[model samples]
Target: MSARARERPGQHDVAHPAWTLVMSVAASSLSFIDGSILNVALPAIRADTGAGAAEVQWVVNAYTLPLAALILLGGALGDHQGRRRWLVIGTVLFGIASLVCALAGSLQTLLAGRALQGVGAALLLPNSLALLNGAYSGEARGQAVGTWAAAGAISAAIAPLAGGWLVQQFGWPSIFYVNIPFVGVAIVIALTRVEEVSDPGSARLDLGGAALATLGLGAATYGLTLWSQTFALSTLAGGAIAAGLALLVAFGLYERRLGDKAMVPLSLFGNRCFTSLNLMTFLLYGAFGGAMLLIPFTLIEAGGYSPVEAGLALLPLSILIGGASRMMGKLAEKIGPRWPLTIGPIIVGIGLALASRLAESQSYWTHAFPAILVMSTGMALAVAPLTSTVLASVSRHQTGMASGLNSALSRLGGLIIVALLGAVLVAQGDALLRPFAMALRMMGVVAALGGVAAFFGLSGNWRHADSGTETV
Candidate 1:
């Protein structure tokens, strides 16, 4: 790629800015749509495959664990290698994995495919965002990120509705098959339109840090998922958790020792704003992820709703976020991210708390719609700004790593919550309601804490200056 393309593709003609956005959105939609669709399809999958609650949770976590673990390395590799190259490669891998999933005849085969999908997602997501970062700057960057978020939200909105119908009409495998054509389109656009960009002086690959991170997160996730299933701190679960924690601590120490050479540069945490924003990301996204999984399951299993109805219940969230996030992103560019970041998660907390009142007898318009509407409004306010702020927290060269870390944290939050949902998952019919409500309320408090983090951690006028570092 030309130097101009690497530094500022928006200013040159190597690729149209609009096409770059399209390619990024299309590539990201693979992950976003897969997640939303799978939530709707989970019940069908469990029934068809005779999966217990534990195995069901594994179906989701199998994808999330690896995505969370290796995403930082993916970002680092993109910086050291080439962003566009990895983007295409990831797309192809994801497509193949989707095919494998579509053809899977057993739980183990399905899990292997899901794990591959996670690996592909890990490779693609950060680079997609980094491509935009390399192409745009300042207000335009915020708008582009907003557009990207909005497009992904729109895709997510459509996925469940479409996936529910497919699952209901054809089978769960149809959901996996849907990804193939989308992946093909994304690959073509990425290869033809997106310019390759990388930092020439980027550090060599941190294989040790990557290994430690993968093992630590995988072990922790395994322990937690097992604990949820067994509902006991058995020796196996306890040992795995203990070992995982120790490995994570060692991973942190190793990264710190490696300095800038680590897959995760510990120095990024030195920026108070960056640190606080990511903490908020973890808390808020955890709540959102848990809610996403539970709400549909509750509707299907407890409330006697069909998959289609359950999917429809979340339509408000997708529409509101898709419609409003771009405007919110621009608003944050002007006023700074502090207030949006603070207020959004608090509103989400309120919405989740309200949702905990859900009952089987309650009407969707009266109970579910109201809660979803409120949560949607809050996420619309927060999502775009949270992403833009994280990117702004670091220099241009670190955009890939920064995006990866934020994305990883979001997935990690979801992975942990899903792992902890074993008790809820095992409950049947009306019994599911109580535990589900408790989880929602707990998640609400977590979301509220995220709001508090932003309020205290970021200055009111904080923004990224021309130097590519935050200022107030």
Candidate 2:
């Protein structure tokens, strides 16, 4: 280990933990707000720019693909360099990308900007958490994380509503412009108040692995998006998909060779519980990503809801998940994660099924509200336990890597589903309802399968699992 790598976590303290927490939350919110807000603004973006379904899908996936593929590398970069330095750099880059997006007049320009935003978010998200972990210890660390989670939940709840209002009032470009001030403030605070911290010993940059993963995911997403647009797999699409799979396989082999030094230590997957939990994460989150995008679009286009009203429709999900996740987490500690994990996704499936039955003429209170309430309750039950169990499943030293991997999988799930929704994305007004319903029903099945995976794949007594080693 180098001399700098030998410096203990405690030696690098922030001037105040609160400032560190504030900077972390503010920086992280850029991605969260951007994501939630863009769903509401997509309709306006398409209307203004005359973008087709494929182009709109590119807008969303362009950001998500890079974020999902490069997130692990981003975390490693922070460890190699300084978290604070990279956090500020990420903020500046995201702000500039937002400007480019806001000023974009063409589909091509907008996509280029969105892709840059994803790169910036990849750097910002993991480093914010790493910075928080480095700045505090023990009880204070837990408190800070809880505060950060709560703040994130609040910001997520507000983003759609706020973004919807902005979109309705000023246009879709205004939504991107809103990010400028927040990023500006976060950049200033990160530079002035946050302390620099890094672990050179653990910071191994697997550039080849990162490059392969990015190319693989990008190619696969492009293939899927093309298939969705054409409803047929052309030779080009098939070739892209095949090449993506091959590259992904190569990525796995390469990581396996790198062992502990790999960006994603493949040994983590040797734990059956960890592997199973991640598979469940992908299925559940993929369903969620599809629902979130389709719900607002359907409401605005088919159900005659304005942008702001469509945003309000999702408030139940945000509020319930935010308010109830801690209670669910505590419950999991007592009874174990098995039951919550099993039942939660099942409930979400039921909710999606209910949502599929919604008609344009149905009242929001009677149809839409009930479905969202059920889905929110299910997510509230699952989200906390799933996260805590993922952490507890690994040894203390691997927790950061494990969490980053899990986060990346979740985003990857969303990215895949969005890429496959060209049909739904293209439909408008009454024509959208049929494809939208079909998509939700299919996602409901995927969510249910996630529940099944949890039930069969996880140990009954997971709390007592040997955390020092991978549980076979």
Candidate 3:
């Protein structure tokens, strides 16, 4: 090891720690940005390939569906194979997949490339957290997690604009091509600066648990996705949902019967702190994703902004939230994740409370911008500590699973919320133009629900951030 690599996590590690932090943050952000980026590009792709809404969703879902499904495996792989190794492997594959996506001539080919990209993302996502956990300790760990959260939020902010510009300038394929350079850089830095850490012992890879979890989430999420787009009750989807639930229940029961390393360490759930923290994160992140989806529609439909214009309008929100997340991490050390976690959704509610009043003539600067900014701040405050707590609340052995679960559940929450919101929208009448008053009322209800979840799932027994490491 280099002299700098010898430095312990909390101590003055050379600039190596900084490099690790940046690369990890950037790598994770790449996955998140991809999640939302293609959302904007869908229309261009649809136009280019003459695809419908359902088919276009495959382009997006091909990435996200698997990312959500197989994320836990990513964490397990990182722990078993060494975080750095899988990180490099995933990054390189992601780049290759992106190149294939860029060159795709038809919708089927594009979707194939997207599925490959998803596989790569699934591998990369959880390992990002595990790598960071191995790297930073104590206050530095807190800061590193904060950086990871901030990067994700910033990516959330920029994805639409960047995607829009790329699509406008060079069509939708450019969006896929754009990933090449970033992944290339990530692979190089991750290999050079990050050290290897792995479980050399016989750490059993619970393929059974992974299979069940994947099927469960896949069925449930896909059913929800279909419901979001089509408001009618789907018997097939409903059946899938039931089957998925059964598999998950079976997975849990199966684990209890095992002595070797189970896929999901059931013992981790015994930690009330960890469970509650993750539950809160799931709801809050749902609200965040729902808001991200709804606000842009509200902007273009009700606020009378062009798509690009609406995307630009959201810029303030991204800036405030990304900046606020880092600061909140510092504050979390003193106050703990619970208070901020509780406060964040409430603030988001307040922002949406204002947003609910949006009128066709509502001033963008006066109404839309402030609402998003406050909402962004609320989300920013909640995420970093929420993530850190979820990880900290679990035992070191299960930290990979804990981190993966938090990330996965948060994505799942978004899927569920968007489906629910779609139901609300569809029930209101399938109209492009939602009058300001009606939009306000709908958002108010959603915000209210998120606030309730925050208060109940995350409040009261908030942990003290300074409480050091204790096995759950």
Best by lDDT: 2
Candidate 1, residue 203: how far the Cα is off, in Å? 4.7
Give the per-residue lDDT digits (tens) of candidate 2, residues 231-316: 89999889989999989999999999999999989998887778888989999999998899889888988888889998998877
* Tens-digit lDDT string for candidate 1 (1-472): 4333363355345667788898888889999999999998998898899988888898999999889988877776787778887888888889999999999999999999999999999888878887887778888986897688778888999998998899899999999999888888888877777777886466348889888988998888889988986588989899999999999999999999989888888998887778888999999999999999989988898888888888888887899887887787778778778889999999999999989888787899988999999999888888868876887766776765776788889998999989999998988789999999999999999998998998887874344453265522
Which window of 10 residues has the lowest lDDT sum in candidate 3? 3-12
- Model 3 over residues 1-472: C-alpha lDDT tens digits? 3211222333323446777887787677778778667655654576679875456445655666667667777766776767678888888878889999899988898888887888788888767666777778887986787667767887878987887678767787888876777797777778667776665352446778778777776677667656655666689778877887888788889887774477666776676677766666666666666666656655554456555666677677777877776687778778655667677777776787777656566678887777887887877777656655665665454555666677777776765655454443332212534433454455555554655655565555544354345421
Scored against the true structure, residue 145 in model 3 reaches a CA lDDT of 75
lDDT of each: 0.85, 0.87, 0.67
The full ranking of all candidates by lDDT, starting with the best, is: 2, 1, 3
How many clashes (backbone N, Cα, C below 3 Å) per candidate?
Answer: 0, 0, 1
C-alpha TM-score for every candidate: 0.92, 0.95, 0.82
**Higher-ranked by TM-score: 1 or 2:** 2
Candidate 2: where is the Cα deviation over 4 Å?
1-14, 460-472
